[model samples]
Target: MEQYAQDTPKWKAELFDWLKSFLIIGSATAVIYLFIMAPYVVQGRSMETTLHDGERVIVNKAIYYLDDPQPGDIVIIHPDASGENWIKRVVAVAGDTVEAKNDQLYVNGQPLQEDYLNENRLKSEAAGVVLTADFGPVTVEEGSVFVMGDNRNNSMDSRVIGPVQLDHVVGRAEFVYWPFNAIRMPK
Candidate 1:
């Protein structure tokens, strides 16, 4: 009985040390995940050829607080309060006029280039179909911008839901971090 008591303090000390280390490490992880960045999984082909389903990436949640979303930025947008988010590319910012007609993208009457797309394939597939449909010459409302997926024909984005408020955007993703071989900076 005396031997057990003598060892109690040593055991308690070791347990306390472990718990303290755990708490500190946990707190740091929580802070980084909640405020700095978050891991997000791509859910669908909406962002295909850019972000694949099941692909994992770290979203820099602090980015928008520092820099406004810009055209060509790949961002995660929350369409509602359900916690579901969509990843898409910013096509136009507040006050910009945007349109998709006969397979061409136009912003403020100037052609918007999408180097990520295979021009020939898109032209052939979207021939006379107007994949994204047409609109605008209408200016994006203040505090909102237009977004879309690289897989133009398959994505439902600003063209369907209308320009999204900047506040609805969660963050911008710059790279893929999953599946090893597919890991790299996203275009």
Candidate 2:
């Protein structure tokens, strides 16, 4: 039956079209994930208040390619050769001097306003504890940044690992997308 043969080919053609569309979409998604954007899971309390453990964030991997990491930008970093990643706030960029004294952060000889740490600072003050201990007068070297956690007292950051090389920075964290009720763009 000539008619039956034509119908069979039409159905096969439709299936082929569907398969091709799916292939194209899959490729686009893979490209974006590899070079443009990717999801990262926050793993510790280091970024607490701003980002909590187990929270999911969408990192804009392509951003740093267009702009250098700057103070106050939340970024994802590959600190060392062990393949571990960290998320932290950039406190000082190349050539900037950073220091913490009397629980206040100073950069370039001026006190830095850290509104993001308001809650934690208040809590520490209430508890008669120092949030960030005195350290640094350390200048960030060329092509590196000084990073710190929002939960200053409990974080392992650039203070512990030294200035993070710009090449080690993975991306800027654009926003948190998981646990619907907790969704927000970290400042």
Candidate 3:
């Protein structure tokens, strides 16, 4: 009976040690994730062909703090100070001109090769719609970057929201981790 009693205390001590270790490890992981990287879910089809709706992606939050977001990198944008975060691809940096004419896109007066888009969708240009309308030769201001979605005609991006200030960018999204088979680095 005494031997049985000693065994119970030994088992309890082992369980207590495990719980403490678990709590410490869990807390550390949460802190690291919160400060360094974050997971985001695609809320819309704005980034289609590159990132789809309902996909899970990891954002490298510490990157922009060390370097500016270059054109071609997909970034999470904070539309307004208090608005919900949105995603878009950086199309042009400061001093660059972005324009659309005849359902074609140009950056710095050179045609942008948008191989990611389906031409049929970009052809939907109703009159007076600025999305694919002829405009600009407008130079982007300092400290801001122009952004657009991969699904050109369907996304509400810089063409609609104006330039995204570098300060308003959250992070660069580099990997998709969800849906198992769909997991891969976005081009």
Candidate 4:
């Protein structure tokens, strides 16, 4: 009976150790998901070619705390108070002038090299359609960013919503991690 008692205590101790480990791991994961990083599922064709609908991406929520978002950074933004998040590429930052003429995007008087839109641009031209419509020479206000989608013709971006306030930005998209075959770092 003494041997049985000792064996029971040993089994219980081992189980307790495993439970502690699991709790620690679960807590760490929760912390990362809540404050450091988060998984976001792309919802529409707005960011297509660069990010397709239903692609899973990891957003670095803590990154903006260290540095301001820059042009060309793909970011998740809450455009309105409705709590809906949209992913887009930052085309212009505070004080930069943005314009789209003849289907070309110009920021601060210089044409942006949007190599990511090569496929979409070619498709548009082949179809005799303008990829990006003509818009403002308006300067981005302070603490705001001008965003657009890689699928310029189909995206509802800053062009439709105006510049997004810095505070509305949720995070920068680091990479696509889903659909196994489509895994890659978004440009």
Candidate 5:
């Protein structure tokens, strides 16, 4: 009768340990990726220069729930209050009157001074309804927001979608994570 001893090769033992560690690390990473660090890719130029289309970003879903959305902060919102996501710049907060005329934007009846826009995009576009000679001094309802794109003429923002309900907001973009060179804090 022959008996086989339990002595194992050092290389085999080391390999087994490495594989176990990798699996643990990989699984933890995936869990965090789906919940905490979900990835998003920009689809339009609505947030151009700040968040370009096709660029990838990381949304901190845990944060907006912790705090309210702030004006001028870029946010990811569900346009229809339905579960789909959309990204747009926050223009006016609740209770503010927003108007656009002669390529200028006025919030609360005061000129909205922005250092972000190099060229205004609201040229010749009617305030509420585009291509109409009429405009608006529309008041954004409480718990709602008026969002617009830096590329005004091209973006279909709050002007087109109407005021966004607060509950529709998904999260604020924390940073851009792709395209290596453009990887940095989103404006």
Candidate 6:
């Protein structure tokens, strides 16, 4: 009877240890999913064709925490005026000269070949020229970025709001995880 009683206590202790281990693992997973690896829902069609409204994308919050934003990367940024977040593609990096003339985009005097843009969505007017037109030869200030939308006609990006400050960039959007077939890395 004494031996049986000792075994019962040992069994209970093992059960408790197993429960604790399971709880710890579950909590860690929740933290990583919510804070690090979760997918964000698209609120607008500014990135249409590339990212659609109501679709979901997985952004790597960990990547931008260490590296600088790169050209051709789609990014999420914060706006001070409206306190809203925006997602757009990085067209011109720091120190690149960006111009839109005759509806063609040029960076550093070299025309950018934007195959991702829809011809119907291209704006005829030079929207970025508002300030650059008045000021002449807009050089993207160091540590700033010029962004645009794939749906060029409809997006309110750096063209309207001016170049985004480097610090305003929140994260690089790495992939779209929702809508099943659209699950792929963003260019």
C-alpha lDDT of all candidate models, in order? 0.85, 0.94, 0.83, 0.94, 0.75, 0.75
Model 5 clash tally, residue pairs: 0
- Per-residue alpha-carbon lDDT of model 2 for 1-187, expressed as tens digits? 8887677877797898999999999999999998999999999999989999999999999998998999999999999999898999999999999999999999999999999999999989999999999998999999999999999989999889999999999999999999899888998
Sorted by TM-score (best first), the order is: 2, 4, 1, 3, 6, 5
The residue ranges of model 4 lying beyond 4 angstroms of the native Cα positions read: 1-22
Per-candidate TM-score against the hidden true structure: 0.88, 0.91, 0.79, 0.88, 0.73, 0.73
Cα error of candidate 2 at position 133, Å: 0.5
Show pairs that collide, candidate 4: none
- Which residue segments of model 3 deviate by more than 4 Å? 1-27, 118-131
- Best of the two (1, 4) by TM-score: 4
Candidate 5 lowest-lDDT run of ten: 125-134
Worst 10 residues of 6 by lDDT: 127-136
lDDT of 4 at 77: 97
Question: In lDDT terms, how accurate is model 6?
Answer: 0.75
Candidate 2: C-alpha lDDT: 0.94
Q: For residue 109, what is the lDDT in candidate 4?
A: 88
Instruction: Please provide, for model 5 over 1-187, each residue's C-alpha lDDT reduced to its tens digit, 9 standing for 90 to 100.
Output: 1232237667877898999999999999887775566688988776775678899899877676576677788788888735677888888888888887765678888877766765332432334434211247888888887777776656778887788988887777889989998889877
Model 1 clashing residue pairs (backbone): none
Clashes of each: 0, 0, 0, 0, 0, 0
Using alpha carbons, what is the TM-score of model 3? Answer: 0.79
Between 2 and 6, whose TM-score is larger?
A: 2
Q: Is candidate 1 or candidate 3 better by TM-score?
A: 1
Tens-digit lDDT string for candidate 4 (1-187) = 8887677877797898999999999999999997799999999998888999999999999999998899999999999999999999999999999999999999988999999999998999999999999999889999999999999888999999999999999999999999899999999
- Give me the runs in candidate 2 sitting further than 4 Å from their true place: 1-8
